[model samples]
Target: MHIKVKFLAYFRDLFQSREKIIALPEGARLRQLLGSLCDSAERHKAVFGKEESLSPHIVIMKNGVPVQNSGGLDAALENGDVIAIFPFIGGG
Candidate 1:
């Protein structure tokens, strides 16, 4: 299956692009895609946490909607789904 993944803001720089299409086995979960995307230790730590789990500080959305209501990291992704990754931001 193929899904579109987008990395926004600082994540884009980390991934070295804003978006890309990734191929995964059918029934792939959000964590699979994340693990495949953040290959390096630096990228992995930035996206995933010290515990190797999706960082709570990072914002993840599925097809324009937040994934928290959809099972979060375990969310089952379907073909053609769009996953957007955004780093946490704070400004005064």
Candidate 2:
């Protein structure tokens, strides 16, 4: 299956772009896709935290609606799903 992914902030550094079309296996979840896209331990650790958990500050949305209600990274993503990921940011 093919899915569209959009990254924001530092994530773009890892994938080299803010958006792309990726190939994923059937029944892949958001977490799986992210790990595949940013698999390197160092890279994952840099974009995410510990490479094992979704950083508390990371934001995920599907079709512009937050999937936080989907219990976070566990959110199931189907083909053609549009995922937007954002890192925490602050301006003072």
Candidate 3:
């Protein structure tokens, strides 16, 4: 299955692109997609914490809804799904 991932804010600079099309096997989950994207130690650390779970600073949305509302990293992904990645931002 192929999914589109959109990188925003700091992720854009880290990935060097605004978006990308990634190919994964059928039945892949969000965890697999994130592993594929974090191709390096630095990238991995940026996205995942020391325990190998998603960093609290990051936010992921699948098909316009926050992944947390679904199953988070265990969320099942489908072909043509649109995933957006960005850091959580705060304002005064």
Candidate 4:
């Protein structure tokens, strides 16, 4: 299954791109896809917290809706699903 992952802001620097086409196994959830994408421990922690929890400051959307509202990282992803990920940006 091929899914589209989009990186916003600093996340692009981490993934080395603004978007990528990720090939995931059948029945793969968001967590599995994320784990595969984060190449290092630091990068992984930045996206998914310790114990594989989604970071509070991180924003994740599946198909334009917040993932938490749609079953979180446990959400079932179909082929060609679009995932947008990035840390919440704040301005003062």
Ranking by lDDT: 3, 4, 1, 2
Put down candidate 2 lDDT per residue, 4-85, tens digits, no spaces: 9898887788668989898999898888887887767766765465546776777778889887777677888889999888
The residue-by-residue lDDT of candidate 4 on 1-92, one tens digit each, is 99999999889888889999999889999989988998897788788876778988899999998897778889999998999998877789
Specify the poorest-scoring 10-residue window by lDDT in model 4: 41-50
**Colliding residue pairs in candidate 2:** none
After superposition on all CA atoms, what RMSD does each candidate show versus the true structure? 1.7, 2.3, 1.2, 1.5
**Any residue pairs clashing in model 4, and if so which?**
none
Across 1-92, the per-residue lDDT of candidate 3 in tens digits comes to: 99999999989999999999999999999999999999998889888976777788899999999987679889999999999999999799
TM-score for each predicted model, relative to the true structure = 0.90, 0.80, 0.94, 0.91
Query: What would the per-residue lDDT of candidate 1 be over residues 1-92, giving only the tens digit for each residue?
Result: 99999888888788999889999999999999998987898888887776666787899999999887778889999999999999777799
> What is the Cα-based TM-score of model 2?
0.80
Candidate 1: regions farther than 4 A off: 90-92
Q: How far is candidate 1 from the true structure (C-alpha RMSD, Å)?
A: 1.7
Candidate 4: list runs displaced more than 4 Å: 90-92
What's the best-to-worst order under TM-score? 3, 4, 1, 2
Worst 10 residues of 3 by lDDT: 45-54
lDDT of each: 0.89, 0.79, 0.93, 0.89
Query: What's the distance in Å from true for residue 3, model 1?
Result: 0.5
Number of the top candidate by lDDT?
Answer: 3
